[model samples]
Target: MYLVHTAHWQFLGLTLGFLAWILTMVTAGLNEWRLWHMDDVSVITSGVAWVGIWKVCFYTHVLPQMEFCRRISMSDSFLPVEIPVAQVLMALAVICGLAGSISGGVAMRMVYFTVEDRRNIRLVFILTGTLYLFSGSCSLVPLVWNMNSVLINSTIDFPPEYYLPVVPVRQQVGTAIGVGIFASILMFISGLMFLCYKYARHTLRSVAPRSTSNPLRGPWTTTAQRSNGVNKGSDNPAFLSEEVSC
Candidate 1:
């Protein structure tokens, strides 16, 4: 049985990629991306309102005061352009990040050694890194664009039924957007790690000359058991056992 080795780079990259993927999921579901403070308002009893990709949350003042949240409609004529774009980009980021995380997870198999070929290992690393890089890019676009919108105090032209301000004086970027930005940076670094792992693996292979005698090769295949640097055929009894008793 071959013993699999997990490189330091692969371990670290997978760990970070997993974290970023989780954060991306959370960011997609979170409703705190855009905040509006209505504390001093005479219109509604709610102190503040927050908007998310899927919903907009405010307060209702009927017989009993309650939080009222509504699903964001993409067909609404008055919605800011950033909201829809953020939704799509964030959704894409989640999907790509999940794929990259899985790839990274598979590449760092420590015990199974299922994929033993050096060429295959390098391919896995490259593919994993590229996916993560794309995930990071998808996450970053919405964050920066929405942040720019907030900086300019972007407004929604909602009808009266929506009960949302066109341009609130106290509106600002919310914590969720900041969290997404941080997650995007983490994803980018994680992608770099996997790519670096590929480069480092290549460098080590070049230094050690691993084609005929790779570190990844099982130790059971001793020097005497090899023919011209290649492992002896399975037909040879040497492959069965190094020492046998009669």
Candidate 2:
């Protein structure tokens, strides 16, 4: 009999995890975390700025937008101690996701282990599941941390007469954050499914019947025999027991 019964669940978990990793990468690469708009200001003077992990983008509020705009890199800053924390963390998360996805793929459905035995297959699933959990954690920390930073720094006080209103024009969460959240959730669920599949597979293997080709070990072919005398014949001398001989 095949050792593992629940291979379908493992495949589902790996697919979901890989998809989540892709979403996270796409979210981290974009630059639309925050936006600012002016309602009662002139189009010539009104403009908007967006925040991202890598750079800040500015655009004019005119109907026909100008071709020129400004972009400031996060690595060029000198006052904030010359370290791009958000970029580094997000890159690390991507790396971890890649590693986890590869490991999980190798462990799923016995695709990578054609020459290995059944007893050691469960270990691969457990290891890959742990890696996936770590990958999810790495992805979650940066987005949430950067979100908090944006909220704290966007607290600028300005009147309505200003061209760039800070009070009414709130800093809303970007599409990247939403996508990252969804990716994190999917990764977490995938890791949990992998772990569950491992446990369930172990349980199934334990209760299954073991196969043996040797007929001597079978219960029906045992060495013991009953002494019923049904095999003895009256004509045989060995069957003539005592005084009443035939």
Candidate 3:
């Protein structure tokens, strides 16, 4: 018999995990952290800058001259002083999540393992669920670290004229941060679902009835018994069989 709840939860986990992975990849790659507006500035000379985790870009004030936008170079001294932590974490999260999804997908349904070996399926589920949880944790760490960095270091450095008139208001939180946070949460939830499914599978298997007949034993046959009867008292027999009454 098939386990309905296990399959349901596993399917849900895979779906949500894949969706979260897509969001993670998109948010990590895009450069939409900030939007800029220019007030009474000419397009030819005046420009507005936008910053993201990966790079920074400066664009002309005029909408028609957007093609003139240029990316600022990060390698001023021909080397980066620090590693790109955000990029690395997000990449690893995606990779691990993908592997977990594949394993979990295979483990949910046991079409290959014979009835005698079905117990091994639970082990696969446990392993995949653990990997998924790890992936979720990895996704969360980077996002929380980035958020903390932004909160502590976001004090206004530019002159008052550059931003809104509010004294305490510094920078606006970008869409990417929100998306990343949501994705991390979803990933965590998906991992939990997979784990729960694995537990349920184990519980079901433990309580299932065991068949008494040995799976390795072949069907009973009268020919073997007849051979044993003819060779009764011999030291060695051509065929092996259970004893038959005369």
Candidate 4:
């Protein structure tokens, strides 16, 4: 008989995480739409929307299957069937999708702020886009691997009474791990870049000099005084006559 080892808590955690990711993606999509309709649309709008679409798809299709697999596995009355690795991979893909969405969203926000530095803006887009792409790829890994597994494992050991379809659990798990790693890496990179940009801009502004006015002079006033050759001491006749009595 198949023994179910359902990690209910872990499943719940993952579910919540996926939901949060979906929320973030939706928020990003709305933000992008708002920007797009505006006269001052940003270049980052498309990028953000791309990230959001991937996230929504992952949550809607992939995450539910993963949850179902996990729940069925933990059920006491269920057969002792192994969970396919494909499902695990799918879960991981969802996580990666989440990370990508977040990274893209943040990058888009940065662009919207009109962060004058072109270099910084480009860097933000490159890093975030890379994360989004990598995670999206990782999300598909389990599905691909599982299909391959099923094709290869045509004749597996199974009792005549055991009637559960063999799903690719291991492949799924591998995919999930891959996605999780990619997501984590991107999160770290984007966060570091954001902090560095903030610090550099702040430091540059802090040490800059302030413009000041001279206490007793304007440009025209100073020029007039110089051309007139008027001396304050000349008002005293005694001081003037001492040097040139003629």
Candidate 5:
């Protein structure tokens, strides 16, 4: 019965999230290929693929049956129950996950161009890359923690045999917390790299030369003419000797 109440919305949200993830991945991949000349689009592509596959598995194979039991749980209520708060939270997590992944991909590309200092660029890449990884990981928590399952199983209205194997709530909460911590660390590192890059560039520009003399402006001949103060005809033997010697 809980599934009846939550499955449709949950599936809809998941479907939207999956499609967005796919789009972001494709866009990021093509952009990377065109701009960076690096051939490792697979790293981000694989994450999107995994999430999409999992979403399909949940929607087609798992949710329908779960919905049947959920419907039974809500039959007694005359008024449609208000949407579960958990569903709202899950939707937010999915959005954040997608955004983080896209941002991280862009940051990774930035690092490739920022490679004048390997240490600084490496730190930036790690930070932004981890932010995406953690965000995606956090998105899975809501799907896994479907609290509706626990409520339905605990109620006597649902038969014991019909109880579904819900993911433990503790596990879901733990995963979300872990990802949050990881993302925070990544953010800190990214901020540090940005500051360092700004400072380094500023220092370099301050001391660099504004202009340089041209080497091919006839320095040798100019010096000779200036010292002699008079021009000798090219036909003269003295001019020929001077030209040959100097």
Candidate 6:
């Protein structure tokens, strides 16, 4: 059999994990995790300035138009605690997701191809699940933290050279954070599915031996002694009626 759960859901889980990894990588590279709006200002420069773990941007699509994105340093004086924390967390998430993906792919191949013993297959599945779960956790912490900060209009003691307002009149979660949230959820679910698959396969395989271990009682056959006894009327002849040809 294809397994008790049929393995379809497990395939979906692996696909979800791969998509989450891609989104996390994109989120790590994006500068839209948080936004600061300058639309209230009465100048052509008025627009949005967004920031990420390692970079910030300032841009206006109209008059005096330009786009500027520059890397920010964790070592900068008086930087918000969130930035440095996000840098480490997002990097860790990317790394973990990558490791999980590689292991997961290899494990899938081994499973469908029957390349190893059952114990080794179980181990690989568990390892992949752990790594993906860790990746989701890493992403969720920083993304949620920054989203809360934006909700509260959190401020920092950024030095004047940084040109960031101590408190922007308007701020919101950005595209990157939204993407991270979705990716985190998908990654989390995928990890859970993989773990379930591992345990279920183990449990089901262990029980299967008990059901058909006796060749005489196998699903597709019966004991020759039983057949002979029935033929000779030593056993219940009525039972053989069921298997008799017309």
Q: TM-score of each candidate?
A: 0.74, 0.64, 0.60, 0.34, 0.31, 0.74
How many pairs of residues collide in each model?
Answer: 0, 0, 0, 17, 6, 0
Per-residue lDDT over 58-95 for candidate 2, one digit per residue giving the tens place of the 0 to 100 score: 44455445422334345453313211565666677778
lDDT of each: 0.78, 0.64, 0.59, 0.36, 0.33, 0.79
Q: Which residue pairs in candidate 6 collide?
A: none
Pairs that collide in candidate 1 are none
Q: For model 1, how does the per-residue alpha-carbon lDDT over 1-246 read when each residue is reduced to its tens digit?
A: 233444676788889999999998898898888888765545556667887778887766652266677788677667788888888889999999999988887777622455445457777888889999999999899888888877777777767776777767677788899989899999999999888863333233345544654567655563345778887645567655655643
- Model 6 C-alpha lDDT per residue in residues 126-206, reported as the tens digit of each score: 888899999999999999999999999887665655466677778889999999999999999989887887433433345
Per-residue C-alpha lDDT of model 4 across residues 133-165, encoded as one tens digit per residue: 454454445334433443454222323232222
Model 1 Cα shift for residue 185 (angstroms): 0.8
Off by over 4 Å in 5: 1-83, 113-156, 159-202, 205-237, 240-246
Name the candidate, 1 or 4, with the larger lDDT value: 1
Candidate 3: tens digits of C-alpha lDDT, residues 161-225 = 23322122234446777887788787887777766754333434466676666567655322333
Number of the candidate with higher TM-score, 5 or 6:
6
Model 5 Cα lDDT, one tens digit per residue, 1-246:
011222233223333333544433332222111011112233222111111111111112333333121232223332123213323433454465565445444444443344444344435434544444444444334323333333332222213332322221221122223333344334333333322332122233355665455677534332223336776533546888999999
Of candidates 6 and 4, the better by TM-score: 6
RMSD of each: 12.8, 8.8, 10.3, 19.8, 18.7, 10.5
By TM-score, the better pick of 4 and 5 is 4
